[model samples]
Target: MKFYCSIHEIKKTKTVLVGVPYDGTSTYRPGSRFAPQAIREASYGIESYSPYQDKDLRDIRFYDIGDIPLSYGDKELNLKLIEAFIIKLIMKGKKTLALGGEHLITYPLIKAYAKKYKEFAIVQLDAHSDLIDSYRGESLSHATVMRRCSEIVGFENLYQLGIRSMVEEDKLLPHRDVNMGLFDLSKAEEFLKRIGDKPIYLTVDLDVLDPSIFPGTGTPEPGGITYKEILSFLKLLRQKKIIGADVVELSPHYDPTGVSSVVAASIVREILLIMGN
Candidate 1:
């Protein structure tokens, strides 16, 4: 969570972003919380020119608020800090695109966003459904983020994509109405065939991609989606309004070729292109 919110003085910029790098309760690989720093460092390697967004996008002024004050030792305080910071950003009329520490951070974040935009929806890209009640008895852990998001933000507007892994707890979570289409990447094309359209807020955990492409996430399950298919689904999004989005859970240490962060950075670029002027 080192530098997702970068502030640069470009005349046409209209967005304000932040990095929330606090992954305190992750049950598996323990380093995704450090992904924000790696993503920012990788940003220095990108060309400031855009192929989809007009070149003016590179000329936009934005702020990098670095990492927010995280309460690693106190879970309750972590929630408070995230909730307040998100609300503060939106109240300033600046659109926020967060770089995540872990998927768990999304719940508290939505609590703040929902204050002003009640109809907010999520377009999650992940392998696991993340509908657990708790992980090791930790209700707020990353494993239960979707459960929490449903509780705080309301389930009527959420749409989950790329969900293949399933926990027994998730079956009992009562998510029948979440409008989810769960499938392995082998079936990704067919899956999208049935669900043709909708508004979306993209939340991607690198684990959603096959480990061969990004092996640096906290949890890397087999049979994840392919990079080509993921982008294809994004391309299929037609006439839909995307309000805000996030790319979370990339642990750089395990990325043998530094591919994960580059993927994350490139996804951000694509969002800029798709949401173009």
Candidate 2:
């Protein structure tokens, strides 16, 4: 209730970090609920100094606000709860960052934020489009996160990155608002030529990395991008109006070496450093 990683005694900081350990839809590999804990533990290994940035995100005020406890497998209730949490944080004038459960969490997040900002948009970094009508018959499945974000959330624009895998069916989806298939930064560079600029909410799914590089997620796509490539695009996005961001779908059970958690934490740190500045 007070602060995330309670022992750190971090309170009254600008960064309000919260964990949403709700991975009920991870049919392939459950355990994203544990990602927050593992990432937090690995955060101890991270340093504020970075060759990638002139300053650390902590140079500004940042603190983990704590996690939302829910494991009942109720997607509807979970969405409502997430919406309320974010709305409350905005009411408090706190900038919130939610940790992983699954990508589905982004739908409710975008919907809730759109109620506040009429000009909201999203910068999605992932291996899949996540714009399906539904995955396995659920409206809030991880595969369909962006679809719900577009249909229900009402964002003005969306720019996706690192998309290397998708069924042909996903390519023919109804919502055309999402600017899709902008994979690595190199590919995204050519893709961004047409992407222009907008106020953005960032959502990251770690499976975007090639399994050889980081094989820790609910799903792994082999032809995905690299950390360097993903970071390049995010670094460029640092100049835009990035309202908030979430790192999703990082199932820690698969990462016994904890390499993925370190990467997730690094991404948060870098984004906050570059954009949150």
Against the hidden reference, what TM-scores do the models get? 0.84, 0.89
Q: Give the TM-score of candidate 2.
A: 0.89
Tell me the lDDT of model 2 at 171.
57
Which candidate number maximizes TM-score?
A: 2
Off by over 4 Å in 2: 1-12, 153-156, 174-178, 187-197
Angstrom error of the Cα, residue 39, model 1: value is: 0.5
**Clash pairs of candidate 2?**
4-64, 162-183
lDDT of 1 at 79: 81
Taking all chains together, the TM-score of candidate 1 against the true structure is: 0.84
- The C-alpha lDDT values of all candidates are 0.69, 0.73
